[model samples]
Target chain A: MLEDGNLVFAACIILMTAATYFTRAGGLFIISKITPPPRISAFLNHVPASILVAIIVPSLAGKGPAEFISAAITAAAAVFTRNLILSLLTGLICISTLRAFVF
Target chain B: MKTSTNKSPGTRVVFSGKGIAEGFLKCIPLGIGVFAYGIVFGVLAVQAGMTPLQAQIMSLTVFAGASQLMALELWADHLPVLALTATVFAVNLRHLLMGAAMRDWLVRLPPSKTYFSLFFLTDESWALSVREMASGRKDAGFFLGSGLCIYVFWNSATGLGATMSSLVDRYFRDPSVLGLDFAFTAVFLSLLIFFWKGKSQLPVWLIAGIVAWLFFLVLPGKWYIILGGLAGGIVGALRDA
Candidate 1:
C-alpha cells in the first residue's frame, strides 16, 4: 500500500532519525551497565578523527589537481591558525579561485 | 570565567540560563562552520532530487552533518531504503561511543532531559561539552545550549541553501565547477585536525586513510568509510593495549 515516493521518503527520514537516536540513548544505557575501559575510551577519542580522515581520503585521492591544492591550502590554514571557520573559508575560496582562473 | 549561579556548594550538576548563554556564546564560532556545511548539504540534497521541504525536514530531524551528507549522496529515485539505512547506521555508530563517554555527566539528569538532549549530540557539541566538563563545569545546560545553537544554525542554513539551490544552479551550472563538491571533504579534514590529540593518533589516521583509499578502488558503495573507521579503531585500541 505504501507506493508513493513521498511517503517512502518520509518513512526513510523517520527511520534515520530513530536509528540515530538509538545510538545516542543506547550508549548511555549500555554504559550504565558496564564502564568502558580506559583503552576503549582512548580508542573512542581517536575514532572521530579517524572517521573524518576515512571520509575525506577517498574523495581527495581521486580528485584533480585543483582539489589537491585546495586541500593542502585548507590543511595548512587549519594547522597554522587552528581555526575551523578560517580553514573552511580557505578551502572554499582557494578552490573557487583556482577553478575560476587557473583551471 | 563565569560560574553557574544555580549551584549550591554540594550540588554536582547545575542547569541554568547563565550556563546556557555561555555555552551558546562559546559555540558561535563553530556554528559558522556548521552553517556553511549545512548550506552545501542543502544545495546537494535538492540536486539529488529532494524537495526543499524534504531537505529541511532531514536537517531538522537528523541534524548530523556527515550522515546527512551521506544520505544525500545515496539518494535516488527508487530510494534504496535498506542500503541507505545501513550506511547511516554505520556512519552514526560513533555516536554510541560519544554518548557512552558522557554517561557520567548525562546520568545526573532526568531521563527525559538526558535523552532529549542526546537528540542534538553532534560532533561539535560533543567536543565542546567534553571540554567544558574537563574544565570542571557540570552544568547540563551548557550541553543543551551548545546543541541548540548548532541545531538552529544547521536547520536555517539548510533551508536557505535549499531555497537558493535553483539560483546557484542557474549561475554555476555545476557545483563542482566552484569546487563545492569538495566542501564535504574539506570540512571533514578541518574537523579531523581540530580533534587531533597527539602524535599517537598519527598511526590511526594513516591506517584509516590507506584502508579507505584501498577500499575506494575496490568497493562499489561507501562501505569503505565504515571499514576504514573500524580498522583505525581496532589499531588504536591495540596500540593502547
Candidate 2:
C-alpha cells in the first residue's frame, strides 16, 4: 500500500536504525572477547567525563556572552547543589532572563 | 560482585519494580529538558517535510537526539540513503564507547535482558546509570526505568510538536526565545560537574575539551565528539599506565 517515495524513506529510516544499533551494541561484543586491562578500565571510567566535556566544550567555545554567563551559572548551581533539576532550571531561567531583558 | 555470586539463579535477574520506580523518579528532573529537545526536533522534522507519522516513527525507532537532528537537516525531497546512513553512523559512534563503559554491569545478565535494556541507552540515561553505579546500586532496572521515562516523554513530545507544528512555531519562534535551546548544554554541564574528580580527571577533561573544540571549529560534521572522546580516552589510559 506504500508509494515508491514513501518506501525509500522507510528504507532509509530502517537502515539508519540498524547502523545506530550497531554502535550501541558493538562495544559489548568487542569487550566480551578480551579482559580489559586496568589502564583500559581506568580509561573507560574517565570516558563519561571526557565525552561530557566533548559535548559541551564546542557549545561553550566561540559563543556569545549570554551563553557563557548562563553556562557558568548552570555549572555553579550543579557543583554547589549537585542537583540536576536545580541546575537545569537555573540555566534555563538565566538564559531566558538574559535574552528577554538584559541582552 | 558479591551480590552477583551469592544470588540464586532465579534471583539473579536484575530487574526490580522498586528500582525501576526509583530510577523513573530520579530521572524526572531531567525529563523536562529531554521533552524540550524532543519538541524542538518534532517541530524541525515537520518543517523538514516529514509527516507527523514519519517524524514519530523516527523518534520511536531511532531515539537519538543529535543524530536525529542531523538526519532532519539532511532530509530532502528524495532520500539520500547513503549520506544519511554515514552521517548517523558518525554521529552515534560514541555509543560504542558508552556500551563498553557499561560492559561489566551489562555482561552479568542474560543476553536478552542485556540487549533489550541497552536499546534505551541514551546520553541522559547512561549518565544517570553511571551515577547510580557510582552510588553502589547495580540494578539494571534503574537504567531501563530511566530509559523508559525519557523514551515515553520524548516520543510524546515529538508527536505533540509534529501535530501542533504551527503552535510550536509561533511559541518557540526562536528556541532561544526562552533559552530552551541551552537546556541540553546546561544538562550536560551539570552532569559533567557531577562526574568531575579533582586533579585526576582534570587533564583528561581538558584534553577532550580542547580536542573537541578544535574539531568543532575545523570539521564539517560531528566527528569532533568521537575524536575528542578517543583522544581523551587514550590520554587517560596513558596517564593510568
Candidate 3:
C-alpha cells in the first residue's frame, strides 16, 4: 500500500488507460449506428452541460468558506472574461495567496 | 469545367481559406489550456512510475484529461486494479453521449474525416462542434476542421509537456497542483455557461448540479457523473415541458 510504489503505480496507469479506452471506443463504435431521436437527441444535448456542472460542484465540496469564496470569485472572473486560462490563473493566484495569508 | 465554372461568394466563404483559418484561430484560447494540462498529465503519469514511452502512449491514445488524472490519483491511493479500472470506465461513460450527439453531424463525412475527428473529441472541441451544429452548420467539415486543430495542439503539447517535465525536476516533482485540475473544472464550467442560454434553463442546471454534488458525496464511485447527468437531464426535460 505504499503510495507511489512502482508496481501499484504502473498497474493503475495501465488499468486506467484500458478502462478509459473501453468507454471512448464504445462511443466511437456506437456513433456509427443508432441515430438518436428527437426526444433522445434533445435529452443528450442537455447531457454535456449537466455532466460538467456535476463534475465541478463535487470538487468544491469540503472546502472551507474561504476557498469557496475564492472559487466563487474565480467563477465570476471566468464568466465575465470568458477566458478559461485567465479564470484558472486568477483562481490559482487567489487560492495560493489566501493560503499564504490565512493559513 | 461547368461545375467549377462559377461559384458564389457565399460558397467560397463557406469553403474559404479564411473559414479554415478562422476555425483554427477560434481554437487558440482553448488549445493553450489543453496543452498545459496535457503536460501535467504526462508528468503525473511518469511520476507515477510509467516509463516516458508508456506515459506518452497513454496520453496519445486515451487523450481524456479527467480519466488520466483520476487514474493517477487512484494509483497514488493504492486502490486495487479492478477498482481503478472501474473508476476510469465510469468517469468516461459520458463521452458516449458526446459521441452519439456528433453522429448525425459526422454520418455524411468521409470515413477518414470521421475517424480523424475522434481524436479531437474532448470537452472543448465537443462544445465548439455542438454550438456550431446548433447554429445549423450541418457541413461536417466545420467539425472536422475544428477537431483537427484541437487534436494537433493536444498531442503536440502532450509531447512538449512531457519533454519539459523531464528537464525541470522541481517543476515535474508535483502535479501542477492547481494548474491543470483547475483548468479541467474551469473548462467544464465554461461549457455550462455557454450552453445555458437564458434564465429559463438556469434553475434546472442548478438543480442538476446540486444533485450531482449530492450523489458524488454519497456514492461510492465515479458513477455520480452518470447519476447527476440523468437527474439533471430529467429535470431539465420536464422543465422544458
Top candidate on DockQ is: 2
**Candidate 2 local lDDT, residue B28:** 75
lDDT per residue as tens, model 1, B1-241: 3233222345477667777777788777567667777877888899999889999998888777888888887798889887777777877876776676576467767776778888888877766676567557878778878888889889988998899997764554444655567766676777677666678789999998999889879975566766677778879889888
TM-score of every candidate? 0.71, 0.90, 0.70
Scored by TM against the true chain B, the candidates give: 0.72, 0.88, 0.72
Between prediction 1 and prediction 3, which has the larger lDDT?
A: 1
In model 3, what lDDT does residue B150 have?
67
lDDT of 3 by residue, A48-89 (tens): 667777777887777676567667777787679876557767
Model 3 residue runs over 4 Å out of place are A1-22, A25-32, A35-37, A64-67, A70-103, B1-24, B70-87, B135-167, B172-180
lDDT of 2 at B172: 69
User: How far out, in Å, is residue A72 in model 2?
Assistant: 2.5
Q: Which residue pairs in candidate 3 have backbone atoms (N, alpha carbon, C) closer than 3 angstroms, thus clashing?
A: none
How far in Å is the alpha carbon of B46 misplaced in model 2?
2.6
Residue B57 in candidate 3 has what lDDT?
69
Per-prediction DockQ comes to 0.52, 0.74, 0.38
Candidate 2 iRMSD in angstroms: 1.4
Q: lDDT tens string, model 2, A1-103?
A: 3598888988898999988888888887788667888988878877777888998999778778889999999999999999888999999989988887887
Which tens-of-lDDT digit does each residue in B1-241 have in candidate 2?
Answer: 2122213353343667777787888887667677888898899999999999999999999888889999988899888999999998888888888888776567766677668877888878888787776656767778778888888889998999999999987886455655666887998899888887687888899999999999999996678877888889989999988
Ordering by lDDT: 2, 1, 3
Report the TM-score for the A-chain of model 2.
0.87
The TM-score, computed over Cα atoms with residue i paired to residue i, of candidate 2 is 0.90
- For B203-230, candidate 3 gives per-residue lDDT tens digits of 7678777888888877755667777777
